[model samples]
Target: MSDNASFPHGPRWFAQPGTARTWRCASAPRQVRDFHAALTGYSPTPLTELPSLATELRIGRVFVKDESCRLGLPAFKALGASWAVHRALAERAANGERRGRVTLVTATDGNHGRAVARMAHLLGQGAHVFVPRGVHRQAVAAIAAERAEVTEVPGNYDDAVRLAAEAAAGPDAVLVQDTAWPGYERIPGWIVEGYSTLCAEIDEQLAAAGVAEGPDLVSIPVGVGSLAQAVVTHYRSRPSGHAPALLSVEPDAAACVLRSLVLGRPVTVETGETTMAGLNCGTPSSIAWPYLRGGLDAAVAVRDADSARAAGDLAALGVASGPCGAASLAGLRAALSGPDAGERRTALGLGPSSVAVLLSTEGTAANPRTVTDE
Candidate 1:
């Protein structure tokens, strides 16, 4: 694994005026939750409250939404991948299409491909997963375990995405990608919709814990910004006026969303290699850009070393997190300890009374290097 200490950790703060008052509720959350529950055997993941960590961070409370084992998978990708695949198959069946054996294709660094492959195998369909260079051997084996055809691209994740798009050009092949471009927005939108389930679960868990008003701050990891977009949409759509200060976290090596926010438009970055493999995205998803641009309160790009340290921190808290999963905690710690900590905290509304929620997106199963005490 590469040491990421030399990378940039400059945190950016953006406050969008009238954003909290402008958002309106859309009737999609209930439908999304119902769909997942009825078909996917969905159950809410644990929202664990860590008092010790909260005391250490000097916050009122800290909740970690453990998505490591979502739907029997070691990551949260199954929530989106299963829903997208089902939606695609349902659409095909609605059109009276009788393509013999449907095939699903997508590009992923690791987790999403395995989820897509699992969904395809469950639905009695074929799957083709394209992974970028430098992907871990365990991840490739996991995808192949689902009987999906795994293809390793020679270049980066963006190159794998392009190759997957080319491979899915056939009539019988459906591309269940989580990121969107020009003509491929619908499925990705559905993928975002699928992630609404996690936010809904969080809300219920918070209420059950006697905090009915919801969290004041939320830290989420961004790949193509799909999951962060989902978080924004869910919170903004609530009638309870629960607009948490959204914090978007990403690896410094591939901080496409951060770069896009800085440029004031969607732009691709170089996306160099990082230990946060699941977040090694070069570009932001077109479908997610608008929400992220308007709803994000702050964005931070953390080095791989920060994430490695964060994984160890989470492990000490009894939470098994990978580098990508622990990036939210890394960003939080960065915000609280960086040179501009005072200004950043004031700008983000972080204080003694603030309740924060961190999304631990995946478990430390594939990447054993992230489990060290270093």
Candidate 2:
């Protein structure tokens, strides 16, 4: 059933060859990582070793890139937002434009918008954030707390993106969307580039832990697939040719990336409400599609209960994570213990000695949304 039945409500897993593809980097990965390092209050987020969880999962080791806080934001979105905003402003300045202040506009389910607003606040610029209906009021208030203008669209996340795009017209505003379509790829690509810092930091942390080798697998949570794209591109493009098996996790109600990969081309879906609010995307990013198709080893969707349980499990282990952030754990469990798990594990070369890394992309306070599956 790898290629069949990719509905939004079903839990599914699909694997692919994940051939490597060439991409012309807008900026070198080192350059992007160093740029974040030079930022004020810049510090490498923790790569926590979860030996207890690893033992429970029957793996050699498990390391989670704990992204609860980065540059004063509660999610890894700040990495992309800061870099994309900086690139956009630098591009405008290169064009010799003398605008008093440029407003950054973007749409978000929650974390991305708040991160963008934080960047705009830092640069003393304006931010106009568009959120779809059903995003928690707390998330909206967080954006407003950054002194940004928050607008609620009446439809889904994609609709908010549309409104944000429309509002970003003219020289005084720049659309810093994380998803890319035709004629709007630059800023999104910059955002993808910005996410390389996470992978770079993981490498440094792993080396420090005396595990200088790459993990057998990495589970990444997908929201429009930009961060997963960054991870795939980073690993596949490595000179050492040590790209691990990359698995993307998403909510069952919003498994756009999973459904798209199942179809072999990007396809929009009827996204429903999910506890992983940050991942409630209906469509995959066009710019990220190629890299994901060519470099992602697999994609899976998990239920709200699973995400909540995963969040609780991580919290019990002293790792602070939200449902959206803990979706990686949920999906990793599904991939390794669900139907045909033995086949999947054997296929991925996973065993008792397999090492795995999960990207915990947010903290609990990042998106205070309730998760009661009705």
Whose TM-score is greatest here?
2
Worst 10 residues of 2 by lDDT: 365-374
RMSD of each: 4.2, 3.7
In model 2, pairs of residues that clash are none
Error of 2 at 314 (Å): 0.5
Instruction: Go through the candidates in order and give each one's C-alpha lDDT.
Output: 0.83, 0.84
Clashes of each: 0, 0
Q: Once all C-alphas are superposed, what RMSD does model 1 give against the true structure?
A: 4.2
lDDT of 2 by residue, 249-361 (tens): 98888888877877788988888888788999999999999888888878888889999999998988878898889999999998888558887776566889878999999
Q: Give the TM-score of candidate 1.
A: 0.92
